[model samples]
Target: MVTKKAPSAQTAVDVALAELVEGERRWAAIPLSGRRALLDQVRALTGRHAQRWVDAAAGIKGLAPSSPLIGEEWLSGPYVFAAGLGALSATLEVLERGESPLDKARFGRAGDRVTVDVLPTSPFDMLLLNGFSAEVWLRRGVSPAAAKANAGLAQREPSRTNGVGAVLGAGNITSIAPLDVLYELIAHNRVVALKLNPITDPLLPVLADILAPLVEVGAVRLLTGGAEVGGYLVEHNSVDHVHMTGSARTHDAIVWGTGATAAERKLAGTPKLTKPVTSELGGVSPTIVLPGQWSAADIAFQAEHVATQRLHNGGYNCVAAQAVIVAADWAQKDEFLAALRAALAQAPARHAYYPGSDDRVAQAAEAYPRAERLGPTGERLLITGITPSPAEPLLAEESFAPVLGVVELPGTGAEFTAAAATTANEAFAGTLGVNIIAAPATITELGSAFDELVENLRYGTVAINAWTGVGYLTPTAAWGAYPGHTIADVQSGIGVVHNAWLIDRVERTVVRGPFRPAPRALLHGEFALSPKPPWFVGNKTAANTGRLLAGFGADPGWLRLPAIFASALRG
Candidate 1:
């Protein structure tokens, strides 16, 4: 096996800290307008290099050039970043004015606003926009107080004690490192030294070039390496706040040192001294399919829904629906499973990106000896009859593969909802996103129960009808659920990512899409063969829409309606 190696600790720390100081100094001197201009440059450059970026990422992931995953990575991925730019542009405008609509608030005295700015569009925007909204709502509606806090954080000098941030990036997603750095720099007004996970080190230079504006502003710096490099950066003296999007084990090792040190901390009831750290770790997200409400079409639509969530990016996502909790007594249970099996069987087995994934599947099989295997890669879409043992690894652990285990419960809508909620709350993982699929009438009838169930879910984001992954792509939806967690209990993660406007957040977001099929949609089965046909809503279409939406976003007038209809019709 060829294990990717990280940079030496001494070199990693020296380069990282030096870059940090330089970035902080440069960022402090740059005006907000200059920052916005730089961001505009990035947006322009991203458009120019869109194809190259998509191709490079697809190549690394071993995806076919014409694969739907390519379109997804290209269209959905970059589009999310573009939306981030729009949000950041709006935010910068507020910062430049030194006073926003937030100043008229009844509570909290407004201070002389300092203008701190960083790169605008990137995946971080998706994290920030959602995080801000969730945080605002958690604090009880959209209050000017939270907005002011966000603005205040943005304006603070990066060299300040609370302003230096260390971001440890994940290997799977090419955009994760940049997004992580962007969030800390733009949202929190922090100078960032990002440590790249070794798995994706080959893309570091390309990522660096793409994020050059932030690097030029000294707001962001990229460091590459493995365990030692990560440890050195996280434990560095200058680093005040830290964030990571990786495994729970990595988090624990960082928060409470490994081996004897970890044991000592556990026994002492207090961790060894450390600065604040936040993360968005992995999870075994669950999707609950309500009984009796779904028709055969509904079952098929939802089967694809769950399949897309699980198969997207080869099931490496933290929010990938890992478990399906359904009503055992539902008349259509078997039919639904059969359809799901067929749908999954059709999906080409993805490259098992993470190491030891096969072993994880083996472990799951050991727990559920009767698990059904699927696909040519031994990538079993395991179906487990509800097992009596809660200690079973299939039920307790995150398999992090294409494998899914089904647990059945006896109930209709309300009963199933309650049971699913209980299962989600009691699950060992802290970071989770629950998805519930039911008919419109069923939703209306059991609105309160559904709401209660959603509220009771411990996961960060609860998606209804749509895939929870949609929440990650939508700038308006928050990503991570658990906050204030260090690498120690990084169940899902500590803080939010992809939020563009950098609002303090609480709770997960609920993404709701249309229940039935849309005839003209790219995601429809009819369009599956060519989801990214020339007219689809992707990078190229995005450029066309950007020109149209700029006018619409600035002024929503009926004059733009024709263009909007044209775009929709073309798709």
Candidate 2:
């Protein structure tokens, strides 16, 4: 057996700091046009090596090398990176013409705040990502005019640049680490030295290939490391800022300390690393199933929608629906549950890929001994209860495994929606993601009432008839918690990422999709959906669908739609 150890963080920092400072200087000095050119190169490289990138990520995660399910690695991986490149390039292009990227985007008024429509920006995206649209609700008092001036702070205020940032890559997602680094480069004008997660560090070399153009220009550096390397990088004087995608526990230890006295220090507002820190931490996300006149087909579509949201990535997702809230008095509660159970029961066995996932699964199983084992291999589990108190493990903690707990509450229409919103806000520990599943008729009946319902939810990203992960992938949607969390109680951690539009201080992003794309995209498996969704693991055509989607996103055209639909039809 052989072993590889990360270099001493101190030594790594010593070697890189001088060069990083110079890189940061050069990064800032580069004009908007130059930045656009840099991103153009990144986009080309990402598309050029898309398959190889997906292959490397899928292999590491133990997915079948050619399995359509590996489409997760493709869409969430290279597709996201390539999409970010295009979006960031457009943002810089706006700046080159002395315009605010925020102003360049379309906006509308949502209550007191201004909402910028972030996605489906062109006829191309509309033709491609049909049935999906996203908008970022700016923080209150941020008028559309103010939004333009406040956007792209780094370019507007050059003095605010933090020279070099250390991005601690997350093991779970292939694209997150690279995309996080790109934000520091594009938004803050900071050169980055990214320390890849030990769990997925091997993918670093492959990512390096996609990001070679940026690395060549000294915009990014890739490093391999474990806790020691991460600790060193965060504490090193040379590293001016840090960001992460992990647990609040990790963020605390880094921002506070590791000793027995860590908790007291955290309470006292004492110090550890003084450098500015930002993170995308995990949370116990919830989905509220609003009562509707759902037909049998609609019930089944939503069942898979809820189950697939949970089971995606083998349930090791921050946005995974760990908690489900349903109206107890609804006529179709049992029907929905039966459909959901049927979907979960048919789950294909997946490797509990993340470290410590088995223990977490066992813990959830122990907490709810009555929980059903959904898969033959026992990789998936379901915990059912009638609104367990907020203190229950199912509600308080992130399962981070294939365990979903359902809690039922009383109500029908407005009453049900209100109670569901309250439950998701107070009962769930995270403010990361939430889904509101309701029919268009129900919404139309609610009319003006629906807007308030959307406003009431505190989660960072709210999705209607879709997964909050939609907001995560949309380059315009700010991905993080619903604002106003300090380092002390950092629920879903702090800050936002994947916001390539260069807007700032986002409150939340709203993404809405048809319950089913066209008639039976999720029901009879027929759809008008373009760039067919990759989240459906059972779709036999998922791999081809993913490849076609990646192609369409990179180069949207009328010529490509026929082929994309052909592949989508095969599923």
Candidate 3:
């Protein structure tokens, strides 16, 4: 099928910027009912081409035709679109019923801050996410009363001018760009001008198809090009808000000048671009493993959990675990490490699809001269035991590759968790994702101590016994770093996204998972979940499993359950 070629970069930018000028008004004027109907249409359109999207993304990345790694494409591609649309649909449904955005959500107050249980919005969410739950903790001084009063900011302040939002798309995740656009539209009530990352341009046609309804309504405009085009768009006078999914370096370059000029400006607390820029930048995210007694099976399961955190998407995710923080005095540290090595060894590695991955891997090696590169037996290196340079690159830069490091802290038990939190907060430069893998007993033992530790972690999304990306997939769970970011040194960018609840004041989200995998033989249990959850690169039937799961979510019926269950079992 011959497709219409994208216009020249300059022309694309001109067209996008102009379209956004009108689109923002049109979008803001669109009622919740209209938005709901359009989103329903978009969901159907997205569901129609899930397979072609997976195939195109997978094949272009050099993944084998039958490779389970294609699951990454399906999950990050169609599944996210379907899930995000469902979330938006639900929010619109609430508005249609003349209720607040989080009307049914249970809100709790802890001292001055407000806590909202946003996930598991329905019994179906509980069933879909068995053994998993998520909650959003509002920023300090945000009382539940204030939250309740200003719950639906977008809907309440519809006449307010949000102008236009320009989203600099991430090349890796196929869902990221559109998902970010959705946040800007539904949460901020702004029209979006999305510049597709040049690397993922092959998926642009697919994206255009998925977003056709919005595009037709003049609510979204797609542009494509390298840095030059992005540079032009960011500096475009009409662009009011900027949201990007890339490195901090890219953020700085866009908000400030490049090289010495940028450094000087950063030091002076000055920025070249003075806009409300929001970004989900890279970070040195660490997964803390608390010292605890564990059954052999539990050890194996958590090991896979850790491995999946690092090896997912070949560890290219901004939220992927870059370092493993283990308790130094733990008796089973070596046992868990061995199990992790074995799990990684069993998992297959694909090409480092992202550009500059090799350089990033080399940078990690340079940081720890004695580091040994471990692997999943393919064209990749999982760097282990990197000397921690808290202020420098290894422990600061986001290594967007299948590279990981292990650090064993001297602190143990609650002390260990506190120390790990300190390291994650003080050492890592970005606050996008944080993971803590503690046994249920450890959490219970720590009690309020664990809650305090979580409160201090300083990430947009925090997960226990699960990858931080779980927060990314949680629609109601806001996805982005904690607030208070400056353009000079935007750690994980400014502002947040994936906040389907339309909560204006968000601090962080906590997603909890089971310590062990669900039972293998049956579909129903205490921990029923999507097989290997498409994020796992090792699941052989991930593509089919993800498609079935996506289809089920888009148009769920009892008939689809059996096929989804069967495919999930295959994985």
| Overall lDDT per candidate, in order of appearance | 0.63, 0.80, 0.79
Tens-digit per-residue lDDT, 407-474, candidate 3:
77886767887888888888777888889888777888998788888888888889987788888887
Best by TM-score: 2
Ranking by lDDT: 2, 3, 1
lDDT of 2 by residue, 249-295 (tens): 88888888888688788778876777788889879888888787888
> What are the runs in model 1 whose C-alpha is more than 4 Å off?
1-9, 99-136, 140-152, 156-163, 269-273, 388-390, 483-488, 520-571
Best first by TM-score, ranked: 2, 3, 1
Predicted candidate 1 versus true structure: per-residue lDDT over 1-571, tens digit per residue = 9998876667767776877776676777677787777766666555555556666676777777655445556544445565556556556666677754234323321122222112223333222221111221233353455555654355433234235688888866666666666677766768888887887776666667767887776677788777887887877787889888877777777778789979889677576537887777777777888776566776776677777777667777777777788888888899999978776776665567677777777777776677787766567656667552346466566667778877787778788889878876675455557787776677778878877876677677777766776666554345676444544445777777765545454445655555554542334322211121211212234334434433343333567656754543343
Clashing pairs in 2: none
TM-score of each: 0.82, 0.95, 0.93
Tell me the deviation in Å of residue 193 in model 3: 1.0
What TM-score does candidate 1 get on C-alpha atoms? 0.82
- lDDT for model 1 comes to 0.63
Candidate 2 weakest ten by summed lDDT: 523-532
* Clash numbers, per candidate: 24, 0, 0
